[model samples]
Target: MAERPRVWVSQPLFADIVGRLGEHFEVSATETVVQHAPDAVAAALREADGALVTLNDAIGAAQVAGAGRLRAIANVGVGYNNLDLPALSAAGILATNTPDVLTETTADFGFALMMATARRITEAERWLREGHWRQWSFESLLGGDIHGATLGILGMGRIGRGIARRASGFGMRVLYHNRSRLPEAVEREHAAQYVGFEALFERADHLVLVLPYAPEHHHLVDAVALARLRPHATLTNIARGGLIDEDALADALGAGRLAAAGLDVFEGEPAINPRLLALRNVVLTPHIASGSLATRRAMVALAVDNLIAALGYGPDAGRPPSPLNADALTHARKRGA
Candidate 1:
């Protein structure tokens, strides 16, 4: 019998769903969640034919330097910033990500967070729980209004479009800024107008960040950008945390330069800036934008499908559904790897 290919799962995932990989490969799954150091990640991938990783694991050139056996990496999230594409391509390894499956779910959470920030939901709850809501004072717990407001979205991707569609029911005037403008039909369908980057900050009553992270986008929301926002505007980030300068945000919120903020992802996540925690106006959540049970399961299933196919064992063998670097597969084949 031919030897079965080996695979590594970086963190504990849905047991039954990930167990499916066992049928075709020798699976090495971590029992507990771990913050893998670069060297540790390299050690694990050194012997595996493929890996199933989440955002928690960072894979780069040094990690895959001599990982000749690593052929594919199935990322369980839409964003692949955790994986260094150039490095993986040089290593002749295919990469796949789970997209579309979490689009609506993430958008739902993004809008919810925005509303919560605008209405001071969590802040109110905390105050009420602390016995501060003695009576309905006219000016008590005042917050920005959502209905008939200008909703500005950065990054007009699928999730951004979903948020815009939801905004229509609230009678919001939607504006968006992206790398390029969406087609006229799409703009009409969502009733979203394209605007320049600075104009988005100036015109928005509420601004939501859904842009993917890139090196150039690091700290895109610094003090200068925050100053562009109206003092009454709310800022919500359902995107990557590295996109915001948390200290600058904290300063803005502390000084009341901005109304409020809702953040789902933070820089150095699982360990947030203490400054944000001190601010009462900022609402923070552990990254759970795609936390809906059904959607999360779908993401895992898609990743499983990608892994099985990329490893050349499933019905769609050699044709992963969402390959990030398909050319790597061809390169591997040419070298008879």
Candidate 2:
């Protein structure tokens, strides 16, 4: 019998869901959590026909320079900024990500985080836990109101629209700034107003960052942008950490320039800024916006399906549902033809 094609799973995932890959191919999955360096990823891919990776593993030109046998990569997250798409395309490797499944789950968390930040829920809990709530002072732990406030969303994608729908229930006005204005129909569906980048910062009562990270977007919310916000306005970031300058944010929070912040993703993940940790006003969660049990399992299942189909081993062979570079697959087929 022919040998089964080899696959490498770069991190530990739900064994049962990932075990599905074992039925179709030889699976080499990581037993422990590992922060894979670029060179380490290259070494693993050198022997793999395909790889299942999470955002923790960064795969770029240097990582895939000698991965001659690597044909497909299934990322278990919606964002693929960790992967170098141009290099993968040049190498004729197919890359896929799990998208739609995590949308509502992530949007749910974004709204929750925003509410937590605006209401100072975590801060008040900590104060109570420390036995500081001896007397119920009327002025203690005051927070911004969510209802009847203007919500400014930096990115108006599917997740952003979901958040807008939620805000409607609270009677909050939804304002969004995106690369392009959403269609009038979509605007009506979400009851969202289109605004410019500067206008969003000036007008929002609570600002939520749902934008994707890119090289150009580094420090998109720096001191200058924070300066535009109302002194009592809150900031919630369910997006990438690189979008905000940590030092600037810490200074803003410390000096009371901004009311508070809720951050899920950080710039140097797993190793957050020490300054952010020192501030009580900032609510920090370890990059778990889509952390619900059901949602995570769905993500893993979708990634596994992408891998099986991308490798021509499943009923949907050659038609992975979320191909990042379908053009590369087409070119390869034409070359073979």
Whole-model lDDT, candidate 2? Answer: 0.93
- In model 2, the clashing pairs are none
Q: How many clashing pairs in candidate 1?
A: 0
The TM-score of candidate 2 is 0.97
TM-scores of the models, in the given order?
Answer: 0.98, 0.97
Backbone clash total, candidate 2: 0
- Against the reference, the lDDT scores of all candidates come to 0.95, 0.93
Residue pairs clashing in model 1 are none
